[model samples]
Target: MLRVGKKTAEDTQTPNNEIESSVTEWSEKVTSLLWLINADHILPQSYVPEGLENLPNSNVQVVEEAGRAFVRMTQNMDEPLYVANGYISATAQQNLYESKRQQYLEEGYTEERASMVIVDEYFPGGADEHQLGLTFDVCTDAALNLDVDFGLTPQGQWLEEHAWEYGFIFRGAEGAPKIYKPWQLRYVGETHAAIMEKLHLSLDEYLAYLEDKGTSYFSDVGAMHLDLIVYFTDSLSEIPLKIREVSGDNNGHYIVVCYR
Candidate 1:
């Protein structure tokens, strides 16, 4: 267990497997963040990828923006997701193709039954959110962007209320050329999620906040891995972000996000 005090990301640790209150549990992950890097990304060691096969044949749709290729997928199909999933190198595009194929098979799909377009010839990396496999895209209306009424679907609500639980954060919000996607998700894990949700942040605001706080919260050396739970498309949402305090700091300042 880990005990976290308010206002800092530091805590005292307990032996593993010791159960505690919600605060302590979040504190545990916060304090022991050094061990969570492996679970944060799909490369190296994939996180608890239990139901990847069941994720459906996430069509390989590509987009080219500013001279880069980005790989994306369409929406849900008429069937449930399968249970045949695995992870390989991060930069390797083949792993994505294979995962999609397996997912399609699990959905009772055959070659003739393969539906959806495959635009894998080129990819334009949209943003960090895509690299971490956190946020997927959707066609959004430009005029009403960021309007709460526009993003009220169950999935959209999940992105708003629970995406941070999976280490994903909201990015690229609040400006032209960079739109605010309530549907967009990034792998910021628990700390970012908790704080952002509590703060009700958009992508642009969140990044600016991180930089201003001088918190090496993302993609930087000596950065800390915030904790979070990943709920697959078919699974019950994990790690509720219902406002809670995480571990506190002693050696240095901590930016904690509480979760279970």
Candidate 2:
């Protein structure tokens, strides 16, 4: 498990001038958009995203904001992008795990090796990002399947350069641990996406970094004119400004970002 930090808002420092705004200005829905989900931070089986919208020409569904951003991304690109995977439920994930595990066993692999392979390739049930409607795997018509080779293609290259603008991050990019599928992208909104990309941090590392610091600030990122004040806290009452975004670290704290 990742180490959880215990920094409270009172322990952190903000700039001399704080933004005078109300925390209720931003919707509570922003909280779930950037949630850190993985094996160590498993998603609950009962969890399901609100207002999921179906992407065009795909069986997959994603949150409305993510779906809209994806549409914008596709429209801006010269070639078409397709959703290869999105929003897998716990039951569906179990089926996929069993299928792959059985295939490995059929290939004369031992039970332990088969299980290990499954864990590396596919997370079981509630432990996967696929269970979250905010994550998606993309591919082009020529490359319907996800693989490292797709990263060499025009679609992948374009996404690498511009996905953050649409609030998506390449989840399996460099510095990411375990399975590294270049096609996997997770929605964390534009501001945080820009910050994560700038720091070259995977979601896991980024969360841990912020937790250690207790607080951070950024200016003029992603066409956002106002300065951003970000901090980690387990208690909501400790935040000093209007919370623009709040994401659970999944390790006992909320990563709060506010604008001034």
Candidate 3:
């Protein structure tokens, strides 16, 4: 079983303080396009991703790659889908958390109970995926409200089935410790997305699998063969040159997608 919760000190080195070594040189694949942000592996309050682009026909914005994939995904959908929330700032997340907690308290819940309830649905400042600019809450015209039942709707069901094809994943699904958020979609790029879908793994589970295996994972999709190699090391020197792309797992490892 995959362990869930905050990362321990042993799981990852502190941000920006990666251990330097003379073993190898770093590659340019260490970009924001593949950051994995979550409750445990949070982004800093002042951290802002580069190349943020507004989603066409929507007020929300996401990372450039995600925005492009979202546009393509929306175009392929039969029904109209809308982006309800995206690119939340750390301050905004703090406000949202406080507001929800206060609302619960006003409804006669104790302070502790209110806090517990809020944690189930809201992420604290600097610990939310929205800050990464690669996550968005989507909705349909008929169901503008977010609720578990949304998963049963046509639009929601369609997204669950095909979002991965466009590099998106239905985050915080059932069985995961977090609340079921059928409307929330996170972009991790097409390669990782496809591999996760094929393995039927959540982002957390998939990353854990990569870390544990420490070997190249191969998957055959149609006529194309995808190879992914994961490395857990404190120094960039541990990475090999055969790596075509590299992405931080946000927990303490680098995932290298190999190309022929």
Candidate 4:
């Protein structure tokens, strides 16, 4: 885990100035579509998405771009897909998490054990991607109630294979810190999604890979002739002019997408 401790005067001074300078230099870059929101990195309780919209056939809301892509992706699927959850408010998340935790406690688990068990499937309040309005829990049948068995279903398999093509990714799975939630998808935009799928990297791994590579790391997605340039810097002055789109890893770096 990346531990950020409290900064002393000297530690804060230089880094603060550098960040200010970087922010000023990259003021035109805009907030990224690929922002990473997870348990370790959280959204504020007041953080409502700017483009929330109702998904076409569901009452659940998602950011506009992701909603559009989701609609298209679902339409192309051979089987029906159901939107089970999206855009949960911090309060609602808190309530649900607390309720579940209490249920676990009533079942005789200790407080710590209850929290651990609950978090294995649900994030507490602000520590979830659902608050970002760019995530959705989908299932082949709404009645299945989001069990691990969904991962074995045809709809889940289809999404695992094709969700990235529409800028979504299976956000959590086994072998990771979080529970395996095959039904949840987070939209990180098509360029990054495609690269992540091709390289077989999780979002966390992909972000770390970008940071290690530093600036000047670029790749081409062969068939589309798409150029991906990754920049990890305190400033964005070095970003290329032909940039088609920009996404932040939300961990102090930018990914620029361009076409050849």
Best by lDDT: 2
Sort the predicted structures by TM-score, highest score first.
2, 4, 3, 1
Estimate, for each residue in 196-252, the C-alpha lDDT of model 3 and write its tens digit: 888898877887787777765565731256555556444466554455556776655
Better of 1 and 3 by lDDT: 3
Candidate 1 stretches with Cα past 4 Å from truth are: 1-129, 138-150, 172-180, 215-260
Comparing 1 with 4 on lDDT, the higher-scoring candidate is: 4
Over the stretch 7-55, how does candidate 4's per-residue lDDT look in tens digits? 6777634455565665454557555566777677777888888889998
Residue 33 of model 2, lDDT score:
66
User: What are the lDDT scores of the predictions, listed in order?
Assistant: 0.35, 0.78, 0.74, 0.75
TM-score of each: 0.32, 0.85, 0.81, 0.81
Q: Which ten contiguous residues of candidate 1 have the minimum total lDDT?
A: 65-74
lDDT, candidate 1, equals: 0.35
> Could you give me the TM-score of model 2 versus the true structure?
0.85
Model 1, 230-254: lDDT tens per residue?
2211111223343233322222334
Off by over 4 Å in 2: 1-30, 173-176
- Model 2, CA-based lDDT: 0.78
Number of clashing pairs per prediction, in order: 22, 0, 0, 0
Error of 3 at 92 (Å): 0.3
Ranking by lDDT: 2, 4, 3, 1
